[model samples]
Target: YLFSQRAAWKPALTLNGFLSASKRFVEKDLEVCVAGRTFMITGANSGIGKATAIAIAKRGGIVHMVCRNKDKAEEARADIVKETGNKEIYVHILDLSETKKVWEFAESFKRKYKSLNVLINNAGSIMSQRDVNTEGLEKSFATNVLGVYILTKSLIPLLEKSPDPRVITVSSGGMLVQKLRTGNLQSERGRYDGTMVFAQHKRQQVVMTEQLAKAHTNIHFSVMQPGWVDTPAVANAMPDFHRSMKDSLRTPEQGADTVVWLAISEAATTNPSGRFYQDRKMVSTHLPLAWTHSSALEEQKLMSLLEDLAKTFQPH
Candidate 1:
């Protein structure tokens, strides 16, 4: 279970913890070095997304925040500006849960911004009950997996414009699950366990990322887990999870550190695509069972599903 309120989880990240983290990881000055680099971060109004946006902005990079709520995005941008004194941050409306809207937004974005240096697919949700979007897809799958698929596909041309394009998707440690239910992907025929279903989708994201890497040689694709960052999504999913893992969880700023590392670090340019990463370093992932876990099969199914969905909306 995760806690839904911020008040309940704020105290867990103390000054001592921040100091310990700075010692463990290389402290960077992003603004001086990261200027000119453009980044698109989803769910940029709060939690990990907000932290990542601020981190990129502070580093002197242009951060285009894609969030669902305009008001919340403005508030987040204001705060980042106040803290970092960087006014290059821009906000764009995008709701990943709504498949059609996401495509429309992505097309508009590409038109406005000719080239995107990095695309961070970080927005996600873990709903209490099963819910479907306007596209008639499961809410979790729509936002976490399918939305990412469409957005990445829509932005391919823009991404290709850059000298070296990178797609860094935020996956989860929970992706080490049993199998994917290709038959009942929406959980329409059976029960929906929040944790299990969310993990399955996250796993799908990792495998899909690998497949994309294989399919496209020019684009660099990598997936990362932020190590159980304290966020509202977790709190909303399971009410008790926050308190239980208070000491072990990382702060949003700390969590976004690796995201920045993957996006801008010179070391990442040489790293191979489709690798699973955590805490700013490469890591091993658990191999899944035969029928449910093949990268080729998952990629094929996802592409077919997304292509059909894309047909409904006219791309800009």
Candidate 2:
């Protein structure tokens, strides 16, 4: 029975990959106007995040570019303004791996803006070696999972203030092979493989999306996989994969298609919440692998651990 349920998703996996390659899934009919709506995207300096930011800015949305580097962030913000002719683009400096900075940025954002229409947690990294930040958390887990949790939780009040609020988190197709490691949330119990750890963090983001949707029913919480985009980060992080797939990979704009759609499209907002999506359609979160299916208990436990971690860093 387990095998049958898991096998059902295999076709979806294959179809999704084909759609990504052909670029047939881009949302081209987006006509929604977000004139005064606020959108804050992390890692807005480059790659999929930057692409999503520019797309939103072009629609007259007030985009807040949250990035670690002030210079790069400013450059991107300027380019977005020039291209979109929308001057509401603002830049905020933040290192998401550091929990303190995430909290500080969220608080500062709330002070400046009355309503947050959308918050896209798009910043993530893959470390070749295991490293810990100042908070004693694994670097990849900290930035991808905990930082997302902290920022999303902190900004919930702001999101609630909007008429149609949404939180779109960029996960990865790599998560299909991972299951929740409940006991070793930080990968402290066994040998650490950076690739697996990154996948684990991606899985956590999807799980968190499910829980957050239930906890905040009014807000639309969606997690999506960008699906093998040809970004500079990919080039640097996975050189061999980049070299091999250079001809077949999707562009950053192609990857950010669903993100922009989810942010503005009325059609996306009408869909159910807490769903994992790719190519602008809902996709299965697990594959046919025996280890890929996680129990409800495991998901709940993961949520509890993440909530506890976020509480510790919540600003007083």
Candidate 3:
């Protein structure tokens, strides 16, 4: 696995990094109030996703919360409604690890919803063990990569219908250390390292977002690293790291700041699409002098592989 300690520097992913980066953010640029626009956010039950939902809801935007749990989604919806008093919050449940179910859900979503102004690919999974599903797909890859691809691909037609369509994916800084590896997309080779596997998936996401942005000019696509945040996912996935970095991690809201800005602020869209973002500014996908870059052929293979995998689950 391609690993670089310099790429995933501790201070860069800490709260101090956020504070430093946020100092330059144009506060006035994010005052947009989308009273009628609809936003779909996955894993909106809690953490950065939920924080983004709350921010949009407060601005009078209709929120479609895509969550994995019914009870948790409803609870989060209630909280958003109570806090924002917008009352347009809606919830849909589907496990991201279930590939066929994700495709079916996307189809059903198109039939039900008319407009989706923005689609936030926020939900991600990092499994400690290399668990394979019924389709023989690894759990983390299925949830983090294939599931996102299916949902986003299926809804492209609907997104194109919107006047201001944008797709923002929440990737990780951990991806900086890895390159897009189409040869072993399912983590079948070498020792099972969850962090590295997840990083590879995140790297794939960055490349995929870039490719999609180039393919669809009408729809803006962006990927971002939210820095280190204190959330349940982090706590569950890396308890030791979470404990050590407890005081240094950013809050869920702080982590969601850039996401909310990208969704609402016109300044964000003014920049080029398919670019990687940190805080509110566009940043390079690769680290300084890092050999994590992949060839055009590799990126193409990734999309093709995803398409082939998705075709098997297509509702014929």
Candidate 4:
């Protein structure tokens, strides 16, 4: 099944096959309105995150663009407002790598809004070299793993207040190559490869989704891999791969399709939670490989580690 689904990536088949698949999953003609719904999207200034924000805004959803750069975020917000004619767009600036900022943003958001319909953990980084944040955590692991964990943990109260609460995390197809490293999450013990570390973080996201879903059955927790998309982030982070696959890569709209669908589609909410999706369909989280599968003991250890890390970062 994985190999068959991967056929959409073949150069000769992508234009016809993948493009059409994207269109079908986009829910373009579906009249799903989220007029009163509120969404918070991290890293909304560019790439798939911006595209997801626009899709939600077009459906009359209140969008809060959580970004690190104020100017770029406001610019994107203006563009969304002009294009979608949805003036309910807002912006909050914070560097997710900063644990303190992540906690503060969550608290501030909860205080400002009565409810949060969706929380999109879309912000991510692919560092070429290992870098540590002020908190002395590896940059990619801090932003992609710890930061998301903290933000989601802090916002549980606000999400529970919503009529249909959902948490949609944007993971990556790269994670299929990696497995959870329960003890060495920060990659401190080995020679660091940025790509592998990034993939590890993505794998962590899928595990965290399952853990959260099990703990909070009332809130839907879904993580998805936006297939290789033609975005600025890709060009910057993986230039060689981008150069090779640029012609056949999916557009931002294609990448964000399932994200928007999961956010508002009744079909998605009704489906079982704690699943990983691609192109609007629930798919296997790991490929058939010896190292892909982790023991239940490892999963429990990961959950415990994440919970401890989140609590350590929580504001006093």
* Best by the TM-score measure: 3
Per-residue lDDT of 100-185 in model 4, one digit per residue for the tens?
Answer: 78888888888878989899999999999888999988878889998999999889989998999999999998788778888898
TM-score of each: 0.87, 0.92, 0.97, 0.93
Model 4 regions more than 4 Å off: 1-17, 23-29
Sort the candidates on lDDT, descending order.
3, 4, 2, 1
Which residue runs of candidate 1 sit more than 4 Å off their true CA positions?
A: 1-32, 287-295, 312-316
Clash list (residue pairs), candidate 2: none
When 1 and 3 are scored with TM-score, the better candidate is 3
Backbone clashes in each candidate structure, one number apiece? 10, 0, 0, 0
For lDDT, the strongest prediction is: 3
TM-score of 4: 0.93
TM-score of 3: 0.97
Flag regions of model 2 displaced more than 4 Å: 1-29
lDDT of each: 0.78, 0.86, 0.92, 0.86
How would you encode candidate 2's per-residue C-alpha lDDT over 8-115 as one tens digit per residue?
Answer: 644333434646444654345488788999999999989999999988888889998889899999998888888889999988899999998888988888897798
Give per-residue lDDT, candidate 3, residue 45: 96
